[model samples]
Target: MSDTKILTLIEAVTAALDHEMGLDKEIVLMGEDVGKNGGVFRATDGLQQKYGDERVMDTPLAEAMIAGLSVGMAAQGMKPVPEIQFMGFVFPAFNQIATAAARMRNRTRGRLTMPITFRMPYGGGIHAPEHHSESTEALFAHIPGLRVLIPSNPTRAYGLLLASLRSPDPILFLEPKRVYRMVKHEVEMNGVALPLDKCFVDREGDDITLISWGAMMHETLLAADQLAKDGVSVEVIDVATVAPMDMETIFTSVRKTGRCVVVQEAPRAGGLGSEIAAEIAEHELMSLIAPIGRVAGYDTIMPYAKMEMQYMPSVERVVEEAQKVLKYV
Candidate 1:
């Protein structure tokens, strides 16, 4: 038998935390229900039993306090990994994240660093309630001193979580909860960390480029397969790190394919898709054979459970948009 085990994204998270916590004595994990409860998704399951309460602490149900404590703990040379139960619950702590944790390194002229990893589950699906289904990564990505990372699969989840823990700066690690157990991968328990601020080319093609990250990657890859069956070659790119994006990879792919469609689960206006489209237009406009396309969530608020599917950009919408881009004269 191989020295690898099949693990879901959430299980990958737990494994990464367990492995890293065992290695680094300075690394402490704290958040509401993270100790005895092991997080709402059980991403930290059994860690408290392994490391005890002092290391795997359960904080009060206050987001701001959690963020503040992470900033302070990290400043004192401890690697603090804090969790905000859900993405929507983070706004109350945005000030702490944007002002303190993110800017601490630059603010202190590199004398002090906030080696903190803030974890939260984002995106819509699973029929979650109002605040539980927000995909506002753009909010954190826009901050000047923060790094925003979203992993699309179990391997990336394991690698990225390890990378974030080792980073000397603040990182917002967004987990796609919808696909927490949607698929599994055989992952070796190696301590290797994937490079940060890079794009992963999931599929290489010569026709159109399909770009997306987080849970939207699931639909984007499905659309790529569907398009391939129709004899349309699609190059798929996962923008793992939304902030400080590896635009050169995208530019190279678009220059080769000459057509591109960006899929984002966020709202259509003022989202990262618009940013990518604008950047491509600015840098690689003459190389384009057609106007860049985008398939994203509606501009209105993400609705309740029943209408969630209607609001999300489905595989059909992505294929339709890709076809339109390909057929454009």
Candidate 2:
């Protein structure tokens, strides 16, 4: 039997970080409880023991300080992978991220590179606390200098993280908290990195295009399966990198399908789906048979526990919107 064990997406995150830290002595891991406690989700488990306090050091609970410190360290010639416990808590760090880290390379006139990777778990449906669940990736996507990359599975979690670490610029790495341990897949520890700003076609079809990312990819795939049985022929595309989007891949798929349905766990207003919808309308307008459909979360704040189900876009919801788009055609 192969030595590869079935690993969840969270496990893949730990393994990938461990692999990178081993190779790059300059890569420093810092965050709240990330050292001794191994982070809130234990994604940094055992890394502190292996790399010691010098490399895998823990930080205070201040998000702004964490972001500023990481950017400062990166400016002084260090690759810092700083973790913000949850996406909701990332607000305090936004100023540093948008102003310092993202603007570093351009600000320095290409004299320096901010090889900083900001890690945070995002999205809802895990029944977590208010500050722990939020899908605000679009806020970073709209920023010019920063890059936002989201992983939908264990393999991409491993490969894309490696790529983000190797990047010359800053990267916002958002993990879908709901699916952190939802599915397991065999991912090799070969240290190979996947390309950023690229889309992965999870399923191929000829009738309609279904675009999504993060945990929502699971529901999107499920909807595609049901639509497939009904002869809808849904093509599923995972927007791996939210920023610097690989629109070419989507346009090609949309051209073939003639219809598109975008699903996002975040609110519909100013969400990444809206951006994709705009691009489709501009470039593939002639090819599209119907107006693009968006299945997304509500605009209100992500409510407490049980209400999460209603806030998140479900498989049924995606299917309903997809059906509507096809019917319009």
Candidate 3:
């Protein structure tokens, strides 16, 4: 295992895909521009040269066809990884994902399995044109028979992509687009299975529990650091996996701090934060010292590049919510 530094999240994802393709002959990559163009964000960069065009195929710009074909391929005992260039464009294939791809095992009465990974870059703040920035993980999480995994850092992204390739069920892997070229970290190539349902406590504190996932995690961490300067100890929890959430870790932190703030880049209404808040309210009501608060994107459609900062959650917003929750106790 070499300790190589991954300079960007896109590179980390590409490396993970490359590693998996090298180790397993059954694994094949399919998507628009994946073969020669290496995908829109280059997440599959150089894979075509390494694995050949048959293994790294570039398909038409039809998401439904891409998803349905991948399902068919997986049913035939091949592991297919399909990439949706952007999360907003994923709706074209939602029916296949929620029905055909996701329900294969149950529909077959356990006779067959569709083990496919749907990877898409999600979230805003990258200043891209409209339809290019979106956080739609909540949509997939609501669908049954599907596992949803969101990684906040390069190491987790690399590990989770490998594990998703090995999962027997279909997986919706959401990569934060805003951070795709922002951060850097060292990653190990060991095929370790990081628990998908557990949240990592990035910082331990007794004052408040700041819960966030994906790109928002970076803002939460920054807010925690800024809060620490003001003598406010903040507990940061990274919800790596959205579905089958690790309520154990979340409730534990809420019970300890008695204050919680959930943050996300998606719209506040009907988003993952709503479900998380509901869970806490239902199970840990008595332990709460304040009303569970959330910092999220506005309800309107995503704005243009100039107004993205206001459409998405910012560090200032996180700190404001933290301060509000801190006052409740």
Model 1 residue 61 distance off true place after TM-score fit, in angstroms? 1.2
Which tens-of-lDDT digit does each residue in 1-329 have in candidate 1? 42677999999999989989999999999999999999999998999999999999999789999999998898889999998999989988999999999898898899899999999999999998887887899888899889999999999999999999998979999999998999999998888899888999999999999999999999999999999999998999999989878999999999999999999999999999999999999999999999999999999899999899999999999999999999976
lDDT of 1: 0.94
How would you encode candidate 3's per-residue C-alpha lDDT over 1-329 as one tens digit per residue?
56676457888898888888888888989998988889989999999998899999999889999999998999999999999889889988998999898899999998779889999999888888889887878888898889899999888898888888888889999999888888998777666667766788989999899999999999999999999999998999999888868889999999999999999989899999999999999999999999998999998898989988878888999999889888874
| Candidate models: Cα lDDT each | 0.94, 0.93, 0.89
Better of 2 and 3 by lDDT: 2
> lDDT by residue for model 2 over 1-329, one digit each (tens)?
32565789999999989999999999999999999999999899999999999898888789999999998899888999999999999999999999998998998898877999999999888888777778999999999999999999999999999999999889999999888999999998888899998999999999999999999999999999999889878789999998999999999999998999999999999999999999999988999999999999998988888788888899999999999999974
Candidate 3 residue spans exceeding 4 A from truth: none
User: Regarding lDDT, does 1 or 2 come out ahead?
Assistant: 1
Instruction: Write down the worst ten-residue block by lDDT for model 1.
Output: 1-10
TM-score of 2: 0.98
Please report how far candidate 1 places residue 27 from its true position, in Å: 0.8
For model 1, name the residue pairs that clash: none
Full ranking by TM-score = 1, 2, 3
Q: TM-score of model 3 relative to the true fold?
A: 0.97
- By TM-score, is 2 or 3 better? 2
Candidate 2 whole-model C-alpha lDDT, 0 to 1: 0.93
